[model samples]
Target chain A: MPSLFFTRLRQGQRTLPFPDAGPDLPERFRGLPIIDQSLCPSGCDACVEACPTDAIASDDSLAIDLGRCLFCSECSNACPQGAIQFSRQYQLAASRRADLVLKTGQSLQLAHRLADDLHRILGRSLKLRQVSAGGCNGCEADINVLNTVVFDLGRFGIQFVASPRHADGLLVTGPVTRNMSLALEKTYAAVPHPKIVIAVGACAIAGGPFREHPEVLNGAGAILAVDLFIPGCPPHPITILDGLLRLIGKIASPAAAHGEAP
Target chain B: MTISLPSFHNGEPISLASVPLLSIREFREEIIAAAGAGATLTALFGTPAESGRVRLFSVLGDPVAGGLAALSAEVDDAYPCLTVECPQAHWFEREIAEQWRIEPQGHPWLKPIRFQAPYRPPGRTWARLPGVTDFFAVRGPEVHEVAVGPVHAGIIEPGHFRFQCHGERVFHLEISLGYQHRGIEPALVGGPGKRTIHMIETLSGDTSIGHATAYCEAMEGLGGVAVPARAQALRAVALELERLANHTGDLAALAGDVGYLPTAAYCGRIRGDFLNLTAAICGSRFGRGMVRPGGVLFDVDPRLAADLTRRLDNALKDLEDAGRLMWDAPSVQARFQDTGAITAETCAALGLVGPAARACGVERDIRQDFPSGFFRFAQIPISRWSTGDVFARAWVRWLEIQRSGVFVREQLASLPHGAIQTPVGAPRPDHLVVVLTEGWRGAIAHVAITDPNGRFARYKVIDPSFRNWIGLAIAMREQQISDFPLCNKSFNLSYCGHDL
Candidate 1:
């Protein structure tokens, strides 16, 4: 018992104070992609060609889809003109599907707060059920990490319940494979009415890398109404937490509606 | 007498014509003979052949001799079952039957492994619904059956498990999976297209570094691309870090299953700490977008490398404390001691790999037995235990965690300096290569065959989960039904990797 106490003392206050002041991310971490269309060489489609998931547009404007993006740094690496760079902002979630698309000038459309009636019922204490239809476990791991002592998602009154019937919403991951399509439908149906849905990761949002495969139905959006879209190959845990916080009104919505105040 | 076949090393590309195409009887005889002599059946898959016939290919690994052997046979509609003589081929035969619309005549359990359309058109489809099939049952008034998942209660991937029980004791456990198939192998048939690496990276997300390394090695073998020393070193570092993270997480999970909260809570965070070290090297926590065909994409500067070593040391310090608490607790020990014991003989008979097999003292590790890439230069000794229970599994992981931590620190301390990547060209036509990596779970094998035009003719991935899930089932025999969660976590096999 003495040793246990000593060990606990050594561990000492590990949780981070986040949403107030963010932690320091690694310089190499690729969170959000910033596209400078003016620097694009004439008739050059290097970024588009280099994108494995075709997240970049072929048009002259160089629009990129954050939902489809794996955030692989392939675009940044392939661009000789240095038109594309990945910023260190891990807050990339949105309310609508089209809001995830980043054009050259516009800022990302962040997720809006829940409806007033629903917010009154669930804003303080929200319970969710996670369904991994075709996930590679990347998104699932990060979601699971939120329950750890460091993230301590329970502290925010957000918990992942065991039963869909007990949940206020469903957080779905993966590309929604054909084999799992039925089960996913049944799971979403089991949740209580007025339930919200959040699509996590590139696979759940826009099918990620397995988009055109015949076996996959692209993503969760094909069959369900997603209230929020969290984008990444598997979005970082903070990104997911940020999305959930914004959706439930735990974090205040930002003032800027578009590009970083020109 | 032993059978003679064309043999090669890990990641070595050999001509398709070199593997002797024997008759079905000869192929069966060769595999049985090899199994009797203690060679492991590493991979068994089927490719399309002429006149609507399916060509069955087998890769056997001689762990003792450090060599891999290959042979093939063409079968029309059905072939004699090899599972009766060699139980390891049971799952492989079922997979072949489902994928090629061929039957393994007289096999004990013939069911659709993955309920999906066959690779070739005009082939009849099996039961298309996943987990909608007859399960083996035990009948009596007192006997009851328990069914769980496809949608489990926890935040996890989908798969169904049925336990036939009499009161508290479980008679049998049947695991039905394939709810996560994305047709990854079939999608790779055209070329090494843009989406290939991404698919390989997610083949099983936890083993991203492991699978990515195997695919890259196979591609390099086919294209004859020479990866620089620095790139190979970095790949090894990432692979070991993956091992450290997963092993720690698994240890945490095992503790949680027994209702031990302290170790569970601490090790859970430490697992993330190891993942953060991986993120420090590249960007993603899971090591995605780091490995490529010819070499790695990210380079570790000296300062970053030093920082990683320091942080890794700090995490290891915390892990040691958590591990000690778990081991010292009597309640944890009582639950884990002899709950799910499988014999070493059963392990070899089933061809189990990774820490599950190592827990049985089998010494079947890809790195030690089939050293490729950086493993050829530096080595981590295989950690094993003899009891083959949940305790042994957890103990083996702890031993591995310490060893792998040491390996990462050493690699980071003296990283070889060179270019991170080199250009790799198109693959050679009519060539076949088999690559194996010792992933955190177990041995991961990828077999790639190129066509006349240098396009992928057949690409087969055999995840260790394919072989180990049955091990988890067998370990639960006669154990308390409630111990299912503990046993399942101890093995922690991948459903998507197996389904793919």
Candidate 2:
């Protein structure tokens, strides 16, 4: 017992003050990307060819879909003209699916607030049940981290419950394989009415790299009506927390949270 | 007598024609004899053959000789089962029967393993849904069956577990899993295209670096590409980091299961710190996009290497404290000490790999047995404990965490200087290449066979989970039902890796 107390004292405080202070991400941490269109020469398809998931499309301009991107930064490595660079902004979640697609020179915008009814109901507290359909456990690991001491997602009253009945929403991960499809649907149906479904990670949003596989049903979007889409191969814990906070109208905006001019 | 099966070293490719094909009787005898002579079956599967016959391939790893022997035979429909003689062949024979529609006649317990449709051209399909197979029953008035999950209570992959319990004691536990199958092996048949590496990366997402390195090593062997020393060193560093992170997380999880909160919370945070160190080098926390075919995609410069060394040291300190707390706590020790013990004899018979096998006092590790890449130079001592219980498993992980930390620090201090990557040409036609990587989970085996057109014809990935899941089931027998979570976490088998 003394040892436990001493260990706790030694660990100290590790949680980050997120809304008041921005996250201190690593130097090589690939977050939101910035694409410079003028740098690309005519018919330069190196980035497109380099992408493993076809996240980059080179039509009139280069557009990257975060839902499909693994944030591997292979596109940046393959870009000969210095066209694409990943910025250190960890705020990349969005309320709508289409908003996740970013064209060249477009800055990442904050996710919109939830509906008035949702805000009134779940603004103070939100309970979620995570279902990993065909998840590789990467996303599941990150979701589990949200409950750890550092993140302490419960501090904001966002807790992952054991049963669907206690959850106000469902946090779905993985690329929803055929065998898990029925189980995922049953869990979704078990949630009470007016429940929100938030898709976390690239696999949950756009099937990530397994999009074309015959076994998977693309992602959760194929089965359920998704209210929020958090993107990353497995989105950083900060990204997931930001997405959840935005969905419940806990935080005003990403720009406001970071103290930047909108 | 020695079997006339063609043999090759790790990461060395052999021509498909060079593998001698024996008759059904000879093939069965050779495998049984080889197992009797201390060789273990690494892989056994069937590929489509001409004239509607299925060609079976068997790989036996001779650890003492440090070589792998490959043999094949053409079977029309049914063949004699080797599991009757060599118990390790049980799961492999059942899998071959399911995928090829061939019967391993006279096998004791045969059932659909994954419940997925067979590969095309033969086009056999099972109409039954996943986890719909008949289970082994314990019949008595006191015996009752408790079925749990295709959907579990925890945030984890889906798999069904059926336990026949007598009062509070479990008589037998049957695991039926196919919920996470994504047809990954079949998807790799055509070519090593753009999606191939990505597919390998997500084969078992947590073991991304392990699978990706194995696949790359197999491809490099087939293409005759030499990876730079620097890239090999970097790959080893990433692999060890993966091992460290996972072991730390698992120890914490075990602590959590036993209601030891301080270590659980601290270890969880420390695990993230190690993952963040990986992200400092590459982009993803899982080490994705860092390992490519010819060499690694990212280079760790001196500055970044120093940063990693510092962060790793800090994380290791934290982990040490957390581990000490858990081990020192009598409550944690009591819960973990005697729970879910599997004998070394059972471990060997089931062909269990990784920490689970090591915890049983079986010194079987790919890095030591078949050293390839950087492991060929820098060696890590095999971490083992003989108790074969939850405590032994946790202790083995703690030992590995310290050893891997020392290894990563040493490698980072002497960061090699060279190009990070080289171009890999087309693979050799009609060649078979086997690559074994000691992933965080255990020995991850990737066997790639190329067609005449230099494309992947039959790509087999044997995740350590494939060899270790049965160990978990065996460990649960006659144990308390409430200890299932502790035992399951001790094995920590991957559902999708096995289902695939």
lDDT of 1 by residue, B1-500 (tens): 24677679999999999998999999999999999999999889899997678899999899998999999999987998999999999999999888887888889999887787887677555768899889999999899999999999888999999999999999999999999999898889987888899999997998999999999999999999888999999999999999999999999999999999889999999999999888988888999988988788889998888899899999999999999999999999999999899999999999999999999999989999998989999999999999999999999999999999999999999999889899988999999999999999999999999999988999889899999999999999999999999999999999989987
Task: State residue B380's C-alpha deviation in candidate 2, in Å.
Answer: 0.4
Interface RMSD of 2: 1.2
- On lDDT, the leading prediction is 1
Cα RMSD of predicted structure 1: 1.2
Give the TM-score, chain B only, in order for the candidates: 0.99, 0.98
Off by over 4 Å in 1: A255-262, B1-3
Q: Clash totals for all models, in order?
A: 1, 0
Candidate 2: stretches off by over 4 Å? A254-262, B121-125
Error of 2 at B43 (Å): 0.7
DockQ of each: 0.87, 0.74
